[model samples]
Target: MPHPPVLIAGAGPSGLVLALILLKNGVPVRIIDKERTHRIGSRGAGLHPRTLELYAMLGVLDDILNNAGKIVPTASYDFGELVPKSTMLLLKYHEATPDVPHANTAALNQDRHEEILRAHLAKLSCTVELGAELRSFEQSADSVVARIVKTAEDGTQSEETATFDWLVGTDGAHSVVRKQLGLSFLGETRTETIFALGDIKVEEGLDPNFWHMWNVGPKMILMRPHGVTSTMFNFMLKGRSEHLMNKTLTSDEFAEEFYSLTDRRDVKFGEAAWMSNYRPNIRMVDKMHQGRVFVAGDAAHCHSPAGGQGLNSSVQDSGNLGWKLALVHKGLTPTDLLDTYNEERLRVIAHMLGLTTALLDRNDRGVGEPGKKEFKMHQHGDAMRMLSVNYRGSSIISQAAGAAGAESDPYAEAAGAPVQAAYRAPDAPELVPAGTQGAATRLFEVFSVSAHTVLVFGGDTDARAPVVDALARFPPGIVHAVLLLGQEHAPPSDAPRFGAVFEDRAGHAYRGYGADADALTVVVVRPDGVVGVVASNAEAVEQYFRRILIAV
Candidate 1:
């Protein structure tokens, strides 16, 4: 196969998603994995709403929702039958609030999730070059030179060097990229060995959609329903299991241990698919980008999958980085924008580490001490686990105060314009009624789509004159122009106000910019619908368009 300009070091979720995003934009990408076949292990098994939103953007949400397991909204919090409480609070607090239309999460095994990603990857005709390992890579100012070895089925190997504009490492925890780059992974490794995990089919009369947790003093047992086929059983032991770590255990030993610990011999196992004893360790790479090469997913950070965030976070990391890389390669943006990757992700990682560790500490009992203590308590950290991520403080978003009220619309009754000067909300309103009239409603419609919108405020029907004349005079593709009135807050019923003139309802273009409604100010939102620039004055709007919009 011919070499592509961009080379991705791993074909797991992150690498594949990154490849797909780039490929969609006509960027050439080559994805390679060391494994001879795709992973079949039911590794990570949950997808948050934010992830689903990303999948939606990738145009695969429905496919994923159809293929993955649907997580039940209900959860049970109990430790050794002592204290029992509902887990609704955790779900409510952590999940995305209803203010944004998209909410909730889906749960599925990692292997199945990868299968979905692989299916999408295939459409681009980018095949996974299996049995190929990245041995080393060198990065320079303009490009990356890397070497890989292709291992034949019978064990013979050959090496070759490839040059690419950029190299991304989505490799797992034992990342060769980190070693080659000499980047330090700073964090403590918490060593506790008595843990074992395997996937088993539940009894014929059982249900597997809800997440089930059993806390027996120092030991914590978790059962998560996969698809119609099976459930994953995880046992967290307080002490070290040297023998189990050294050699595999029989299915009878697993059954015996389960009955002895929980006294429920009814729990059963099918043919063991995969079994392993592992120690939980937490760590994060000091940096994500090094010149022409960048690391993501488990390569950039590794933490205990206690909150089921490993795969989710990794996919999100790619979500954050993919678009930026595409824009940079297309010369639509500066490469400096890539710096925001480490800044935004590291901050999120620190917080997730704290929450996950806190949750684990609640269930932790000293090593070698089993059944001595009860469960600490479980609470939902879904919002932090799922949404509310912001790049607000990043260099990408200019730190300017937002404006408020009807006077906020700059195009309102412009000079020589026969438009009414009706007052509207000075700032963007927090929550507008579904049918609320005013600039805020219009701004909401504009922010829904994934583009920078040029809102001509207070434009009466004929007021389209000045803006239309100016827009036609400006270069094409610089900005999307939409005329709005101060009084018409609700979107047009027959035709959507944003996206295209006759388009259906979607997101607000540029986050309801160019109006000073209590809910809106002149705002330029990123394609992801997060605010990038906030304008309070009409001059600021003009200047923003002059500087940023004109270039695009």
Candidate 2:
């Protein structure tokens, strides 16, 4: 029987990332979007450090970084007087360390970010099917048959049916998959407050280096520059209570409000490229999947855009699901592995919803200070970066005999502790191979989303023998092993029997992994860049894989 394709609904960031990941793993996929063209708005523009690391694994970080903007200072104004401390909340972007290379956030409009992902997908010989809407789907014990409607610009519509082994919904809040699954999007809509958002071209004198904000009593207006171009800006206007009634505004009317809020005669506004009157809704389904069908991104959860977690969390949902789906499709693991997707993400999404809701509430009550804004763009603490999010309690993670207890908070780091199972694998620099002269390699470069990476640390050949023997039993391409030798040990001229051998000249990889140089240690990393097990012996390494991977 031919392999059934994985059907993905919606071509937004979540769907595109999922497609790219599955395609990279050589999994057949079919992604469909209802929209006729790509999106153009600056929705969810903040790219946190954790999301950037995932993008690095997906091989699209360079394109995103090159096209994106760095976080800028915030300038606040009250009435006509510039605030004594113009900067909104004294917060500074954290500098990058050896372990955390992407410690700061970057800004790229959602539309452009999706375009980058779409371009990368094209390189894999896959293209998103546009104007194809998922009307409905029916799933059995093993496969899903979906009905899709294709509408043309000339007012013609055609219906077709396709069968796939699995279905994933990455469509926005109004997801047909979730609706058809009868999942309750249980939450409240903040009808008491409403915001107007638009992408508009600003005339000269509006400095693009700073995020400008104006607060006059109950009304607040914010202008944020699009990084690549100084002329374009994302404009947001907030109102509360009776003043927050939903209504559309013309370009001239929006500009009039902008001028009135800023009280700046020198600045002028051009046409509004994209505009929307939105009331924040905080809603999410109880689960992400039912049977062979799954929901992700806004389809699974949605909340106010206060902390800029919507797109980042959505992309992460895809990242968390992509590898497990690929492994199950390849028969490397049982279908039970897929169940963890919902269990792992739902908890994080719940916490995220609460975080964003609290931020929104704070924004509603004006900052106590006259000229200061409490919740400035990029003012969020370390948690907003999402690097600390983990799946320690995941069913698939097999902790070694003496592994440390799971971190209390999913987004909290366990300082001064060994790398715990299910925690993100931190990146380490300056790794020199046996005979590479002075060249070095980084840990992230050795990790692949398509296979499990096993790092064996030992000082000499004898200490590394057991891991080498155990790894040889595994099939090629399914597992990649690297024998990391301490600086004092010299490798043989020939490569190891299985996998590459590198020398930890600077011991950064050793220390970063919290491994003792004298002890023989084995670290098993999952496809999602999470450390699955930290084994003391090679037997523990073999046992851990036995729990997750199918027999060769």
Candidate 3:
């Protein structure tokens, strides 16, 4: 097609998700990968609850949940004797409330996750160009020109140059994009920690419903069920530096060591599907963007796999950047809006790096203390679920005068409370307008990645008219107005005259938003599902949009 709007140099989860979201929003995207074929291993296996919610918004949650496995209890063994089991159920799945629909972590192989994303990408009429490696790129004031080498099956290579409005590098840790930008991937690489990981079919006797772990002194072996098959598992082994350093283990060797460590002669190993030697590195760039070029996913930050934060953080980075990039490209928002991608994501990555690092340190310390060595699934608090991550202090998020006192720090919250400005917009059930006697629809169903959602809450349509009129001035698709009325309010006779008008039949929508029914409140939900601004009047709402949206 004509020069695409965005060129994504990597087809991993981050790049794929970024391209998919942009494409779904009608932004042209060209995605490329160095590898000729899609990956095959269960590399990153943990999907946080926050990521699941994002997937839902992207229209891929059903595909993911259908193909992924549930997080199972982890069982620890010492010389064939069973120890206390550590389950993620510490925050049980049943605890999921209406506001937070996905409360539990999910287990899915990264390769399979990418497959689901690829399928969705296909629906958008976009296919990742394989065997196309980004050799180098240069960015000017208005565009980026990139040189890519395309390798054919016959081993012939051809180089081509293309220009795009923007460039994003989602390539992994050794990101050429970051290096070429002269940005430092600053951090430490623990020479002491090395792991041999593999995906292999296992013999009978081992329960696939539980993650099995064995810790013996400086050596440890973990076997987790792989994909939907109980007979296959993703295995990881950590041992003395000498044992893992620059070493590759064969299938027999891996199986032999597994039996020796666990002392379980009954367990057998089949063919190996994938294997690799890895060194844990905790590193990140000082910033995520340089001019028109940006780096995301493993390119922006990488850490120990202790908590499986690498993939989750990367996916979120794209989620945070996609909408901003789309709006800017469409000329609906100012170019400065793109700056918030770096401002918002850099802090989140820093916090995530610290979290994963701490977990790594704990794992290291536990090695010496046998009592603590018993593998227990980390008890993930709200932080691990990523529900607590916010942009409360962001420049774009404007709150009412009194509401500004809620919290200046994005990471701080008052234990349990309704969603706040600069925080994620929680989901709520909305009644099908007053006249229609039907089931309630979710708040997210009405939200889109291409527009801002204006939620006017109160029983009085007359009071909400100004806010509706303020939104009406903007382009039709740029702003979506939804009227959420109290139970007592009558549904408007002419529903089509107004935008989507729903009744807060159960008060869940009002309570979830923490809005007082007695007072009028307008909640501006950004394309990314974060509450951009909370205003008491239409004037404040107009001013908020003027600051970001170009047409306003």
Please report the TM-score between candidate 1 and the true structure: 0.77
Q: Residue 421, candidate 3: how far off, in angstroms?
A: 0.9
Better of 1 and 2 by lDDT: 2
lDDT per residue (tens digit) for residues 1-552 in model 1: 657889999998888888887786678898999988777777677677667766765777678888775555333434323222443323443333323334655666778788888888888798788989999998888889999999889889999899999999998889999889988888867664347776655563234545555455555565556664555443333332335544555666665555555555545676656666666677888888878789999898887766667787888788777766766776666677788778667776666676667656665742122222332234454344454554434545454444222123211222221111111111132333234432233333443223345544433333334344444544444346543423335544422333333111232322333333343233444444344455444444455444433242
**1-552 per-residue lDDT for model 3 (tens digits):** 587879999999999999988997789899999999888988898898878888878889889998887887666667665443333332345477768888788888899899999989988889999999999998999999999999988879999999999999998898889989988889999987788998988877678877887767578888888844658899889883455457788888887777767778778789899888888889999989988899999998989887777898899889889988888888888889888887788877877788878877767755432234333334444667777778755677785455543234444553444756778888887566666677788886777776788888873666777777777789667788887877767776434546788878888888888888778888888877788877888988988888788876
- Model 2 earns a TM-score of 0.94
Backbone-clash count (model 2): 0
Candidate 2 weakest ten by summed lDDT: 400-409
How many pairs in model 1 have backbone atoms within 3 A of each other, for residues 3 or more apart or on separate chains, i.e. clashes? 37
Q: Count the backbone clashes (under 3 Å) in each candidate.
A: 37, 0, 0
Q: How do the predictions measure up, each by TM-score? A: 0.77, 0.94, 0.93
Query: What tens-digit string does per-residue lDDT give for candidate 2 at 414-526?
Result: 55465878788888878887767867888888888788898877545677677777888886677888877777667753355647778788888888887776788888988
Candidate 3 lDDT (Cα, 0 to 1) = 0.80
